[model samples]
Target: MMEYFYPEHLKKMFTNRKRELKDLEYTRDSLDKGTLRNISFFGLRRIGKSLLIKEFMYRNPGNIYINIEEIASSPEFFSLRYIGYIAYWLNENGDALPDDYMEINALIKKCTEMNIKALTDAVTKLNLEFSKEKRDHNFLLGLAFTLPEKICREKNKKIMLFLDEFQALAVLKKSPQVLNPFALFRSAIQNQSGTSYVLAGSQITKMRSILEDHKEPLFLQFNVLNIEPFTREDTYELCSKILPGQDTDIFESIYKYSYGHPFHTTSVCERVKEYSEKCELEITNELISQAFLVEVLSKEGNINKFCRYLYDISLEKARGYGILKAILTVLAEKEGTTITEIARGIKRSPQATKKYLMWLEEVDLITKYEKTYFYKDPVFRTWLAYYEKGIELGIMPKREMLKNLLSNLEEKYLRTSSELGRAKEFETKVKLEKKLGIELKNYMSKDGQIEIDLAGKKDALIYLVEIKWKNKSSDYKDIENFLKKTEKSEFSDKEKKLFFISKSGFTSSALKLAKSNNVTVLDRNLEAIEAVN
Candidate 1:
């Protein structure tokens, strides 16, 4: 009978995440049918994992959401909050209870007043047990975790329990009486029929250890859902909502700088709105540059604070914090560097640096691919570049310094986007080759005036491909340009097959032109291209 409340502003700001919502709903429906599949959501800090959970909880009633970090000061405190939240969530017209009713005494009294005998008894019993001189922490944890199932079964209802920052529960193991809290928790909920758990945490390393490491108790117990950054389309939609009347170019600039991260995108958009309102000026790339600099470099900025927290907390959790910091600094300065280069920068041996890099990787601070390492979040890397240099807090940077930083950022964005585009093009080429059974390579004119992303030759036909890995659909103009380029290229004499691979599909006119001209258009679904001889 508890009504969950989602704020109006949040509802307005919430963008497109229909797929994630559907996934959550599917799990909940499965649980309703007497099958429980627990889920654990993992993402980097400020990646909107918590917001997604909140939105899900708002839509779905009969749920209890607890942020473990806020209450998990000790085993005793966590036990009380666990029981209190369940009681509060189950109470009839629970909104009447004072905000602080989650306190042990308030929860007990509230439950008793509501004549919720099941929850009342459970809370009273827990309070009495905790007060005992020789408390059994294991028994207390079991009782706290199982109370929801017990109460829900009595009421002939089901409950979804969302634990944010669930990895914080590991701290309970430090208590002598509670040797392994995760084991106790898994044991309690392993066979529960009435309650399903959804665990989420920002600490990717700790969460992975708890849920994926075979040695851990909760290993493989929950379905893992990774909360990724918003897509470019979603980012544009969100920015449009925040700062209306902006052109596509402004929105694209925001997406390019934010990289579709909800926090970054929101921060930049909100900052732009502020500047536009105060100065009565239009939103431009220059304005975006100033907003981004303020958000990432200003001490009071939300993004700066978040990055600082991420930097400090990640180091706190990893071993050899000092060396790990050095390795991160090295990567922030020059990403995609080899272990030997990193060792040279950090003044450590390659072997020692590799160990430190592994520690950073474990914390999800940096990732390794093909023997080189890069920061998992490029925005964070940008922040660190200034942070490591002791960028003064709350001081307006010199114009030259700001220009230089923005220039570097623009360059980095172009470089990273190009790299990603190339990777996608390569993937598309491989897929096309497998589907059509043809070998492809990059093709360029002798004067470099026209370059094709991919080209292949098989039999009498030469394939010239133009790949558009962008947010917008390939339009008639794109197809026209490709045709113009082909007409001027040396391949004009050869019997050439044309391919247009667009990630966002093609516009109506583009499709019509492509079909008429016998140009195979491949979207994300490359299977359609197989029909092309």
Candidate 2:
């Protein structure tokens, strides 16, 4: 069994990421066929990018894993770790080596024992250079980066190079010893035939700039793969593993509150498990909510600390930290607000507010769609809302305060649900366009009180659609309401065909009613609406 870089417990707790794993495996297979395709994994922090990489490494041994954030404190340290990791992976049983193997002398001794003279000699020379009064930075970086490919060719072995938090390499440039680190790195790795690189970063914006920005040296050099949050099913599966035999509703609530974020889902479940064991309570929605609150609001909580770190670190990277925070606070209060509205809220001019908003976007704290800005992580926004309200640790929140927080959470959930509904409508629109081969426009009345989910003109007739994404089946009354709305709308005078799409299918009464009214009803099983001749 290959020793996992992550702890055994965490490895055991790892849940579904089959798609990402398959994608990684494809890269590995390509490498086996003598083709190297570098990949870049980018996502929000704690979104399992590192875990996914470690899992891939565990499945495919003989790989080098380096967390640049851990080792990129200085040029020399980074070079040493780079050499050490290469040597560590090269050894037949490197995991058994003493912890000091990270040191140059230990690595040199180990490489000598393994008969990897190329690496040993390189490490020795690098060690000697470091001791000198004047060191050539380019020589050190060039030697460190190219060592793997050199060693790989020497031993006739393929290597997978995983660089977690790879964006930290930019920090090395602050040192005179490592200027233009990314360009130098790109230069060294561009020709590595035997080593495939899988770079991952928690800072999405920086990673995209490094890999996708046209001006960057490494532009279009690596295939970008975004590690998304776990799905609702994955969240439930993980929660069940943490607290087995729990009700479906409990897991649903966990998915709802955690929004399928792996770390948050895990934290919420662990907290719930602790409370259940200590207080001898059954798992309930209220308990889950409290666990979430404790995880987010308690000072000693992991998520709280993480949010604080993220807030501080992100602002540290961007200019106008103070005003950036003010902008974040405004977004936390009312997300999806336009920059002009935000400027008014912050009492700043539009241009200044736009600059601050750009700073926030640069840091990946918020994203802009059209003219409105929204927090990239809604859970973080919720935390900020509570944090701004002074929800202190060591003291229970007052009843009124808890009530207010819950109310706010409920309102936010409703807004999120509405957004999801809109997403479903969009998905339906796309499917309709592809199925019917016609572009559809969303229909809304002048007063905006009446709206059709989708409408398009096909074969001299107008097709109107009403989508129901609720948990329950669309009932007879639902179809009746749709017909009434269409009848009262501006399109009433037009020859319109009616269509109903339901997520959970339709009730028998609803189906019969649709048939009698010449309406087409499609459920989840129905792929597309048939075009009437």
Candidate 3:
């Protein structure tokens, strides 16, 4: 009974879909003018196909929308149900009926006057089962088509009917009736001067085959439009509008996790509301980490819901998925690792790795640069790193899942001390760059010989900082060897300001070396130590 920060309109909160909406509207307008007849709105599940069409109908009240999945049986039943719906709409509005309704009814009645005739016709035409469902379905569609023209004439208004999840209805072609009423409907509405048809479905392949492929009856019948995710700016705007004062990072995290999928974003935000309420501190990295890692992936949450979705994908694909995930896990910890490096890390052949990478790319789950691949959505990466494999591979029970996840969280938090120091050292360099009027560059040298964690330059002066978590006093030999290594490297022309960063204070020997080498030691734990200008 808890609610999070989802848009109240559910998927209707879709904004910045102007291009898609305009294309759809343009198609509808063309149909009103009797120029366009068949249109298909197709995409993956929860990609806003249904909601988009529903919103379209809201603007065009005269339009009729039918959920084909709910009514699908046979071609006849499919037609009849829609016809019945049309009749209900007309009668409620006090609209006049078509003069030849009876005539069309009688024409369809001959197709299935009795069980024997229905089976006989089905056998010869479709080689399908002799079912009453097929007969009723065919008859209904036959009636449904006739009513559209009648309604147009009676009301003197145009009608646009959206066939929802039409892929399911397309299946009845396997029946004895071979009821391809969609094709017939296309013919009926084509330039009928008043009727327009919008065919929409969530199953990407099925809908694509129905309306986009040339072989299908409704092929190339309508404009094809794919709904995409909101941009980072739009998502941030949406989150700000709905949940004021929320951290921009939280919204950024949502966008990264949901890949800007509205449903997924809202799904996460809804929970974020609960998590925010339960916690006293304002939403921060720690709060989000706890909420997402401990709360959402908890046994009581929807981790199993996520599992069911993955279960539907093929097993080979799933294994490839695990390997891809392992690659990302390595990359997350060791940023900028190349493809050859990833192949070694995942222990898969480059050829095999490429295939997995492509699959993830196709699904918008990951991105590849030249040959290297990284998780496209950070939240998905978080989910994969924290929740996915453990649940899928049965590495732990539901309770243990939370425990291990929290354990990893603790380890990451502890590890941050080291990374944070490095980050702050870079931040200080930025400040120093402004003060010194120079630019700074961070370089990762190959051959594992020379590495500069942070560097900044101005004119002929260059400052270099090396980060170390160990106490400086204990690192005298390491510091000497590091300087010796750097001193041996090739350099073009710039004065170097070498610096050593350590948690522990510098030893007399290292400080002496730094002084002699013209290197400065700035211990990270001691931030008050300003740059020796």
Candidate 4:
């Protein structure tokens, strides 16, 4: 079994939440002044909401803690189930519940014991009774407050009631009778002379839906405090304990991987501690990389779950997404390209392509490059490229560009390697111009075509190469079309070198033709393609 590294410093411990502590303190003070009763806490999952309540109970020994999520198993087990649980808690804690508790429990038990016909009659009367003067929910909630009073009276001190995941109880409100009971409970808390409630939950959506929604049973009736994730500084402080001599770079790396997500950050640190026991190296990029790859990336289901949601969308939407993904893949790889160019690559008009772009951005799956619109997000792009094969045809603008560049290069410099073998009678002019550089003012005659791949300019020599990942052989027509484009376009007649790269070796004829034309033919195994910065 792996021992989890639970850091003591600046973790999601109750002591660290200054704002939450202050807010709860204010609530306690109000309760002491006999002015406040209900308070709500909301945040994302595993954010220490339950822990905060437990801490509050630790400080106040005279408090009753009830987690509604645990007690309320189904909608049918409403007041009676809650009453039964309270009865059990009271019996185990000290003695019998007060008169109000006994009274509510007996009443609910009687309603349950009655036959179907009698139960219906009783419910009808209870509804009328509640509608006329509000139900006796106060008695049940009053039980919570009364317990504190009872304890305070015995111990000569005040008590508090901590109800965790209280939102689960609100599910009962779906029934009219259950809802009436809530109003009475609310009234009881509102008029509680002594006890205070610290309600909390890990489910932010459900909690808000129940408590914050105005149309719901409990709305605007409680003060709310939301727990935020730890800041970068706090995370750094916690990490420093486990990583004694680690530098700021390690902290930055941790933040990058975790994005200040408390659970994720802590989990990584726990793994790091385990790794450090064997490895002597201090925390570095390499170590962090290993941690991410081994501990986090090794868990694949997380990303698969996100993609599964996209898969569940309508087929048309999915296809549109495929098109969106491919275009974004190209855009992401190239950083940014003209919108028109993206449309042309995808075989769609600019207007058609813009719609899908808007939809993707709306969902936050991808983002634009500010003034320039480019697509990015490696996972999304990769998912689209692999899963949505049908739509990629639109995303790749340079579909034939790679093949054309390869053929052109083969014609120009296909025999450079062979010529080197016969160096005794040959002079080589195949210069390795800046392993990578940019070219500009290279002529292109057509409006939408005819741009030279590489050019030797004074400022930045361009070394454009085509990428072919799929096709093993280039078609002659592609090469012919490129030549025709170059001849017709009005591009600069500057000295330039063309290079072609393919996933597979070029055709024999294309290779010979390229050598005659002074083109450089590169096989799939081109070394260090990213040699140029």
The Cα local distance difference test for each model comes to: 0.79, 0.80, 0.56, 0.50
CA deviation > 4 Å runs, candidate 3: 1-14, 31-34, 75-77, 87-137, 179-188, 279-281, 294-296, 299-310, 313-388, 392-533
Per-prediction backbone clash count = 0, 0, 16, 26
- Candidate 2 lDDT over residue span 324-376, tens digit each: 77888888888889978999988999999998887788788899998899888
Greater TM-score among 1 and 2 belongs to: 2
lDDT tens per residue, model 1, 55-139: 8877776688878887786777778888777766665323444365567777777886766567777788888987899887887
* Candidate achieving higher TM-score, 1 or 4: 1
- lDDT by residue for model 4 (1-533), tens: 00111223423433345456656666677767766567888765555676666555444433466767765543333443444433433333323333333243454554455333323333344434445554554333334333444443443444456677776665655555444444545655554456666778765566776677776667887778887766655566556666666766686567555545565566666667666776554666656644533342233323333444443542244556578656665564444556777788788898988887766554445556754563333333333433443322121124264354334323432222221111111111122233443332223322324554333444433333433444457544444444454445443254555566555556666666656655566655544222111
Error of 4 at 464 (Å): 59
The TM-score measured for candidate 1 stands at 0.78
Best by lDDT: 2
Error of 1 at 22 (Å): 0.6
Candidate 4 RMSD computed on C-alpha atoms after optimal superposition onto the true structure = 23.9
Can you write out model 3's per-residue Cα lDDT over 1-533, one digit (the tens) per residue? 00111223643455555555666677677766767455677665566677677566555555666677877775544554555445433332213332221122432443343223322232233222223343444544544565666556555667777778877776666666555756766666555667677777765655666676787777665667666666555566566555567756666655554556665565656556666666444666544544455333555445335533543442334555567667656755544456777778888887787776665555545567665566553444455555544533231235555567656645542222232233344345555567556675555443335656566665666666666654334356867876775666554245676766666666676676677666666665435333322
Ranking by TM-score: 2, 1, 3, 4
Candidate 2 local accuracy as lDDT? 0.80
* TM-score between model 3 and native: 0.53
